[model samples]
Structure formats: structure tokens, C-alpha cells
Target: MFGPASSRSRSAWRPRPAPAARPGGVSPRSARRASGSEVRTPGSPPAGPAPRPALPRAAPPRAERTMPQLDSGGGGAGGGDDLGAPDELLAFQDEGEEQDDKSRDSAAGPERDLAELKSSLVNESEGAAGGAGVPGAGAGARGEAEVGAEVSAGPRPAPLARPPPPVPGWPRPALPVPWGTHPSDPSCPGPRAPRPSHPLWISPQALGREHASQRLFPDKLPESLEDGLKAPECASGMYKDTVYSAFNLLMHYPPPSGAGQHPQPQPPLHNKASQPAHSVPQLSPLYEHFSSPHPTPAPADISQKQGVHRPLQTPDLSGFYSLTSGSMGQLPHTVSWPSPPLYPLSPSCGYRQHFPAPTAAPGAPYPRFTHPSLMLGSGVPGHPAAIPHPAIVPPSGKQELQPYDRSLKTQAESKAEKEAKKPTIKKPLNAFMLYMKEMRAKVIAECTLKESAAINQILGRRWHALSREEQAKYYELARKERQLHMQLYPGWSARDNYGKKKRRSREKHQESNTGGKRNAFGTYPEKAAAPAQFLPMTVL
Candidate 1:
């Protein structure tokens, strides 16, 4: 059982009597205050708790400090001594701070001097050109020195405050303005026009980066092998048959070297090294003249068949016949062979000269030229055999058609040649095409249109509306593509890709000639289109 407040509980809760007062009737608190007044030798720290290291707090006004009066003479030795005591104690108390202040002042001495010099110069110029008009004035020098001394004695400008240390979780405040600007300056030319850049031309194949732009497309102009293979257009294949035909014609039967230069007639194609050994079943006699190494003379009975011939003379067999081949005995004393037919010379070569041919033996066939180089002519320069042969001959003074070969190569051969040729190089995209490639998808998304026709129409209008500089960018890109294409295919020509025309069949040709039905009026009739009539409807 616990006791009541008046009993043992009261004794337990009651405060103990205060400790007996110390000697001299002074309490602990009063003793502590008096301890500060006790003097200690300089350099030794104060007793008891060490003073907190002083922070750079602003000092009080100088007027508050009790200084020695100038008017009052030294009253007594004790008073004089005490007058300096307070000041000495204050200086000793802030010794560390004073040293710090001295160090900062020393560090900023040059900058402060420069600022003071500039200010003084500006002030002097504005107020009155101080001693400037005088030829030699020591007054200006004295003034400058005095101003400098005053400025140095005064407080130096506080160094610019640094940014506060970054807190762990908070974002940093905007960094201080660039060094050349003033504090809190907002107009620091923070926004600058972007520098213009020019793109370097690099082929798509050369690029190592794999991105959306480099993807292959069948309908798009090719930029790489993959793109080329993807493309469905084959320009080279379409033109291959025609181009090869023309090329073969030129190669097999080239024009004479010097047709009109000399009075001597040119040799026949039968003499050329390029002439074929055997005749093609489809080639006419005209074509056979170019292909056959040794062609048979035309029959003498046919008046339409004409040829060039020389007087009966011993044929030069020096290059063709070797003594070991036993061709010397077989050489005809006079060989009458049908040479290449003659035609009028060009306007530059004066007038036409007809060298009538003598009737030749129809069964005789000329020997093939033995050496390829000798095909040009005999060893002699001015010899008749030295003259180059004309590949073809026009009908003499008549526009009548002559029998000629339809095609040098068969359908199967042409098809095979086309299949064997390399894939054609794709044409480079133009400015508009390039622009469309880049912006088509963007437009499709914005317009929500999937149809290419509609998208292309919109893109085309936008392309025309683009600024000159914007369009120029695409043009430059296209130019770079073309340049790269040229570098890749130096020998390629646009003419090679010219498409071939389809040959008309005999039945189609007849149909084209008699295409429309004719009446007794002797005129073919054309159907007239009916005019449309818009029906009017009333709106409800």
C-alpha cells in the first residue's frame, strides 16, 4: 500500500535542500562571467571553452569603437596606458580575421589598382582635362598618385560571390554568366544563329550505318546492289537486242578507210579480216558480201546485180599465196570477180565516178586473205590492193530498194545475249523525287492517306511550295548521287538504256493499213462521243 502525500510519499517527492553557498557569497554563474575579465598573456588561448572559429560576419560601424581623443592630452600614465589597452585587446581578438583580410587584399591588389586607375582617368577627362593642356605638369602625376593611394587605402571591392554548393537532391541553379558579362545580366547573347553545315557526299554502299533511309525498294532508284536487284525496271535488257545488232553491223563491215582520197577504187568486204568464213542461211547476197571471206561472183545474166571491177591484170598474190601452199600454179591470169557495188561520192569528194565492171566468170570464188594485217592492202602504199573496202553500196543513181539482211542475230541469240548481260545501273533521283522520298511518309501520317496517288499529288504541291533553300538541299543531295553514280560507272552512257521498239508482225501491219471500215462515201467514219446531261434534283 502506497502512503499519502503527508506521509513517506511527501518525503520521497520533495526537492532536496539547495547546496550550501560557496565562499565569498559568489554563485557559479557569476564566477563564469568574471572569468572573461581575467587577463592572460598574448598568444595563449582563453581559458575554459575555446571560442568558435569566427565566420566572415559583417563588422560593426567604426564609429562605435571608443578611440583616443585628439584634444585630450595624456591625463595620466595609467589613463594613457588604458587608452591603448582596449584597442590592443580588440585587435588580438580578431587576429586571424585580420590576417585573412590582409591576404585577400594582397591577392586583389592589381585588379583594384586597375579599376581605380580607369575610374580616375574617366573622372578626370569628364570634369576637366586635369593638366592635360600643360606641356609638362608634375601636377597630373601628383594627382594620379594621390588618387591611387586613396583608392588603395579604401576597402577593395568584394570578390564575386561563387554559386552555392549543390545540394544532394536539388537541381543546380543556372550557372553564372560568362566571365566578360556583368552580374545578373540577362542579355548575354544566349541565343545564336545555328552555323550552316554542308553534307559530305558518301555513297549508300559506303555507309556502315544501317538506318531506315538505306532500305531497298523495287520501284525506287537504286543506291546499292541490293536496291538494284530489287528494282523491276531493266533498261539495258530492253535495248540490248537493238544495241548489239547495230554494234555487230559496225564491227563486221566497217566503212572504207580512204574512199574518196585516191582515184583507185576500194577493195571489197571479201578482202577484210572481219568477214565471216561461212554464210548465214538467212543473209542475202548483199549481207553475204560483208560476212563471206571469199564470196562467189554474181551471175552475169542478172542486170539488177551490179559490181565494181578492174582491168584484166595479174592479181597480187604475194600476201595471200605462199610458195609452200602451191597456190602460185593456181593463180588466174585474169580473175573477173564482182567487187563491192559503187555509188556516188559524198559532196566533199567532188562528183560521182562509175567504174564499170567487166563480165566475170560466175563460178569463180576469190581466196580468203591469209593475214589479218594484209586485209588493208598489199605491201605497196599506192597499190590498188592497199585501198580500204567500202562496207555497203547504194543503188547507182536510183532510189530503188535493194535486197538486204533483216537481222544479223536470230531471236534465240538476241534473247540469250540479253539474259547474259549485267543488270542495268539505276538512274539517280532528281530533286523532287528525293524530296518526295523523305517527306512521303510524314505526309501520309498527317493526311491519314494510304493511297500513293493521293499522297504523291499532295507531296508534289508541297514540293513546289518549298522555299528555294529547302529545295536546294534536295537538289544538292541528288547532285551528289549522280556524281557517285558517274564515279562508279565511268564508261556508262544514257544512250545505251534507250528502249527498243516492238517489231510489227505481218498480220498486224496489214490490220494497221486497213484499220477502219469505209462506206461508199470513200471516207472512214469516226464515232462521236455523247455529251453528258446533268439532271437537276430538288433538295428536301
Candidate 2:
């Protein structure tokens, strides 16, 4: 009871005809043609001359064919056809000739076409060298030299010289110019020195965007300038010495040449701030002590007697001698002074000006400061007017101590107080802890495990199983977190969080409770849905 479909399936299976009998001993499948005089079946009459076998067409000449790429030793076993052969340079040279032919029809000028061809050839040479950096540059230069020599030596007539067409937007790639080479004749066909290639063409809009971004975020400074900017103290100290030396010269005036007698007691000032800056004030009694010949113990001796190891810093008294006509021997025995200047100012009868005086009308002097944070008082931090003496010697000397207030604080003390007020920073998670935090819930969902200990064990195995590249992500995240933590709390340390009580886990707290009031059902009302759990500091 075969249906129509079954009958059609049976008809579809037809016997394949026996492979056409091999005609005249020739393979039926091969492209070879039989003789023109085809033989008929043995006993039958021969048919009219069989259509003449068509002859195979000849291949085009190699010169007219496109050249194949040369193998640059980078080819593998599969690239047997790419192996470079003799006259390979001719292939590249021919390619340039082809470009020359196209350039004849193009709107571009001959010089530009020639330059482009030269650059293309040079880039090819560099590519063949596997990006050999400096050596590749040399190869490109040599390729350009060969191209120039070929153009000059060949019998082909030169292309008529014409000015290059103007490029309105993005310009064509420029030829490589060696370091220190003159740009006056870039197009001249001469052997150029080695240099890196110009970057590939970029859209004018992209270049403009890049330039705008550069203006917004300026490029990083050179290593030398960067180091100087980072350590401002060193630069400030240098300028401080210069200004300090100038002030020392202006403030110090040696007494008349004799022992024990002091300069006429300076006129007392009503208010120094009220005096016009143009009119020099009399030397303050503070610096007057510096001019005195009293033999006070050197700071070194005083610090030693007190068992302190502080480095001794004496006032630079060399500038004082420049204002006086005296020798070092006439000064106090215990005084330590700096070496005399190479060009000392002539002993001035009146006053010497180290720099031009300000022309601004009488007003307060411009406030001088290093760190703005240090401008907490009216007196400058390092100004000589604020100190009792140029040198900080112990109170053992006859000079009376100045009045002091215990309330005023120093910059260091203020900074400490601010830091004490800041809230403490929590420790950042490590790579493993971060990984567990992210994957712990996922693992719990998949494994149906409520116990965190079991879930963590699974995550630990998964963490180890992860490829190095995958784990590196967590490591990088952890590193960035630590960096942010350091910036937020520079003085924070792990020890600060140590020995502190940790909050009890929800499960632990539930177990600790005796029991919660049960609903009508004889069970503790599913302990008031415990509040959201806190993240654990450690993996377990």
C-alpha cells in the first residue's frame, strides 16, 4: 500500500550512467582535448571532421602582470611562493613606474606624485624590515636614494615641473627628514639621512580636537622641571638665602672702631608701621645686640652645655663688614661669620642700596610668605624683626627675654589639631576580599548554601581557578581602592582598626536571643526580618 509520496521517492533513485567510455585513451575528466579526427564506433562510418580542438590561450607577459609581495623572512612554511627571488627590486621599482603612469592622468603635479611614490617605496622597505626602528629609517633612506638614482639614470623623459596643488584640509604624508637636516629642500632627490616616518594621515577635525584637548590639559612637564616643582622647599630655600643676605646687610651696622663702646643709642620709634618706607628707620635694639662686641657664648657651646644635639646656625655677619671699614680680627672672638663676598660694597658713608627702592606711595610693604597656610600671624615666619637676635642662642646671655603668650599656636600644631578632628578611615578590602564580596551572593544562589563559610570556600576555589588575567582585574581594583584610601586618610594605618570590637553577625545575634514572642503558631515570628547584613572585613 505505497502512497504517492512513497512512489515518488522510489522514482527519484535513478541508476547513474556508466562513466563515459574513455575516448581514444584520454581521461574523460581531464581538460586535454582529443584529436580533430574523432574515431567513430568500430563498425560504424566515421563522422565529418570533429570540430578542431580549441588551443589553450597563452598567459600574459610577466612585465604586464602585477608583482607579488616579497617574503621578508617572516613567512612560514605555507608561504613558499612568497620567497624572494633575484630582480625582486625591479618589482618594487616597477610599482613606482606604475604609479608614475597613473600620476600622468591624475590632477596632482609630477613632483608631488614622485614624492608620494618615493614615500610609499620607503614605507614598504621599512615594513619589510619588521619595524627595525633606527635601522628601518636607514633602510628607508637607502630606498629613497635608490629611487632617486633610478629616476636620474633612466632614459625616460622627466615629468614637466609644476607647482604642487594646494591641499585645503588634511595634508598628504610628508617625507621623513633626518634629525638636524635642513628643511629648505625636502623634495630634492638626494640621499637623505635616517629618520622616523611622519605619522599616518589624520582627519583635520581629529587633529583639531587633539590640539584642543592638549590646551585644556597641558602636557606633562619634563622630568627636570617636574622634580623642581615637587620639592618647592629647595627652590624656596635658595631664594630665602638671597633675601636673608640682603636684609642682613641693610639691618646690620658696625659700631665705631674701638673696644666696649656702642654706637649712639638708636632713636626710639613711636610706630614702625606709621613711618614712611622711603625713610629708613633707625636700627632696632634687637639687631643693635648683633653690632655689640659682647663676647656671648656661641650657639654650639650653649647647645652642648644643655646636652642638645641641634645643628648650630650662626648669623651671616659678612654683609655687616661690607658696611664698615674694619677687619674680622676686630670683631667679637666668639662670633662665627660667613666668608666675605667676592665683590664687597665700598664702605658707604651714608647707606648702600643693594636693589632699587620701590616708587609706590607710602603704604604697608607687600606681605612676604612661603606657604599661605603659614600666614596665621601679622609677623612673617622667618623675618629677623620677629626674632630677638639674628642667631638663636640660649638665654644664658645678658639680653632679657622678650614677653611671650602661650595661647598662640604654630603651623605644625594647627595641622595636628585639624587632623585630630577628621573622622577615621576604614581599611580597604584586599583582592580576595573584593572578589568574595562580588561573587559570594552569586555562589550562594547557585549552590543554595546559606552558610557564609561554605559559600566562601566555594569562592576561594573559584578564585584560584580563575586565569591570571581575570584575577588581575580584582588586583588592580584593590590597588586603586588602597590608593584612594591613602589620599582620604594619609595618616591612617591598619593598626588603628585593630583591637576594636566587631559588630555581631545577624545569625549570631539571632542564636544569642533566648526567644522572640511567637505568633499564634508555636514558632518565634521569623525573628523580625534581620536588618541588612554588614560586609565582613575579612574573607571568613
Q: Which candidate is the best by TM-score?
A: 1
Residue 336 lDDT in candidate 2: 13
RMSD of each: 50.7, 38.1
lDDT of 1 by residue, 443-514 (tens): 433333434544454354334223222333343334333332332333434333322111122123223434
The lDDT of each candidate is 0.23, 0.24
Residue 221's lDDT in candidate 2? 25
Weakest lDDT window of 10 consecutive positions for candidate 2? 48-57
lDDT value, candidate 1, whole model:
0.23
Worst 10 residues of 1 by lDDT: 531-540
* Native-to-model Cα distance after best TM-score fit, residue 406 in candidate 2, in Å: 33
Residue pairs of candidate 1 with colliding backbone atoms: 276-291, 377-386
TM-score of each: 0.18, 0.17
